[model samples]
Target: MTRRPTQLLLATLVLTVTVGGCSNQNHTEAPPPSGSPPAPPTTQGQFTLPPVSPITPTSANAAPTGIPPAVAPPQVDAAPFNDPLRVTTAWMRQFCQTDFMEPINENLSRAATYATPAATAADITRGDTTQSYQQMQQQKLATRCDQVEASINPEAPATPSMVYVQVSAARTQLADGRPFQRLPLASTRRVVRGGDGRWLVDSAVDAG
Candidate 1:
């Protein structure tokens, strides 16, 4: 009877030890195999993005490399008769005619627009003397004369404010319908800027 009880107690102890060994083996984890790929990392709260390259700022008017920039066009003056050559040429064309039939006062007033006060006075004095001689010749010939054609050639010299004009004039006799005379004249004219920003003839000298 004593041997039977001892055998039963030994069997219970062996079963308890075997069950504990099995429980410990099941709870433990085995190591991964050699050369195996690692598992992907798990995200916890928020995802982190990869870094990006920075961009550089550029000017609004900047031109690209190896390219030329755009340029504006040049401005041009639009004033009328603003140059010495133009004003001198205009004066010679108007007063170089042989037909002095217009009134002396009207002619002098018109000439003053192109010439200075002193120059206009001097020119009128010379014109009155010449007209008296021409009138006497017309009366002696018993014929009236009128200007038929005129030509003007202007030359600009090294001086910027001066110009020389050459005039070729022809007159015809009204009675006989024949050519009356030819008057070739050369004059030096100086121009100046007026108060109103216009070019005006300041003085003139008849060279012929």
Candidate 2:
């Protein structure tokens, strides 16, 4: 009888040990397989960095990193222009200027801001057909300048609201990093004080 009771107790203890080992095995965590990529970080809010290379602005897209900021053009609407000649002269400087040797679409677009709405459309049309200021090769122009002398003509007196100015710009172009010369341009430009109380170039007939 004693042997029988001892055998029963030993069997019960072995069964309990086996069940406990299985329970522990089920609760333990397992690590991921080797060579697999780590899981992405989990965060409450999302964020991303700019894609490499594209955010860096090129010479053709942005102003030259070395040059100073350009001086603001004269205010065209600060009451009636006291000296129309002086005003138009300043306008020419801004209108005929380009920064970083940007091509016509990039550089001259600023001047178009001073153009009348109709004139702006006409300029785009002309640029597409008759004249092209874009360089054949992409390069920063050393400088582009126009020395303009303008005067309001008194001979054509048909329309009082309209004013005619004879503009002569003696230019030196360093186009596409090539040797260049002084090219003179003459134009009979029609300027009008638009309804916005600003002077705008309405029409221009170039005498090249």
Candidate 3:
């Protein structure tokens, strides 16, 4: 049978994956019993997708090999040319490094701050997409993973206000418990430029 997308599978297939790794959210709850099984429901080996190129952090479109760069390059030969790559990579670092803890309301609020005005809070929370990160908070899962890597989807369509970049990360720990062995996964995120000329994540299509 064809595999489901990584976003959906990752959410249900279960793990304490880096908390901010996927999408979906819920109000805070007491921590689930320790070793209570990483995810509420998990079915492994069903979701899959073709691989994209690995990110090289030292150059353009590189995801942080781990702990993203301290900041974007101060100068670019041209603003239009460098903004997409530089901004997208920087956002990925913040996106992946979230602590996945309570003030559940505030965590979700902060996560959404990166969103475009047009992006919906509902979708960011429980929309039918690959992210289960939002809902993961409801379970109060703890994690030890930090860092991420991403690449520019040169082929993604763009407009004066919008762009897209694809990112991939590997889950190396099971501190939370999951149905499958640690594996690499990816997502194609949509970003938009705000009035301030700052780029923010508008939304994303997980490999679902």
Candidate 4:
């Protein structure tokens, strides 16, 4: 009977031990497989944590290694007209005088020749009168420049240098067979660098 009771107690203890071992086995879990990515740990009521990123540095502004800032050139003012080409208002004022008229008319003739054929023809037809266009030019100048006054525009642009001359004169007329007093005349002339780069009278016109 003592042997039987001791054997029973041993058997009971062994059964209990076996049951406890099985319970612990069911509760434990195996680690993820090698080469498999690991799952994130869970927080309260959540399955996984959000992803985290690695930090990178940034600069406000960056310039290239060898570049430099741009700078502008300085500007200078131009020189006086009379000082450049030795031209004065008096010189240009004589374009209409008889002795000076031919050279100026020659320039005009050249200008007209280069014009359209119709214009050149018209100039020829009108040039036939006794008061030839050249003579008329002289007469008109005598009448207008009888009382000549000149004003100098000191500053003008020229590559080899030039001068601008202006003349204000008067026009006279006869009314009722009596000569009338003079009326104000206005004209402008440009002295420019010609083909030779010498300052020469290039153009003249009635400013008004």
Among these predictions, the greatest TM-score belongs to: 2
lDDT of 1 by residue, 105-142 (tens): 34445545556687677677666455664553443321
lDDT by candidate, in order shown = 0.46, 0.53, 0.48, 0.40
Candidate 2: the clashing residue pairs are none
> Per-residue lDDT for 41-71 in model 2, tens only?
8632242221223324432233232322243
Query: Residue 64's C-alpha lDDT in candidate 2?
Result: 30
Taking the tens digit of each residue's C-alpha lDDT, what string does model 3 give over 1-208? 7666987787764665555455346546689888786764542334232233554444333432332222222233234333655554544433333333434433334445455545547444553232455555433332222345666678878888787777655432221332122334456778777777776666766631
How many pairs of residues in model 1 come into backbone collision?
A: 0
List ranges where model 2 is wrong by over 4 Å: 1-84, 98-103, 128-134, 139-143, 158-160, 176-179
TM-score sort, best first: 2, 3, 1, 4
Clashing pairs in 1: none
RMSD of each: 38.2, 17.0, 24.8, 35.5
Report how far residue 15 has shifted in candidate 3, in Å: 62
Report the CA-based lDDT of candidate 1 relative to the real structure.
0.46
Question: Lowest-lDDT window of 10 residues in candidate 4?
Answer: 66-75
Task: For each candidate, give its TM-score against the true structure.
Answer: 0.41, 0.50, 0.43, 0.30
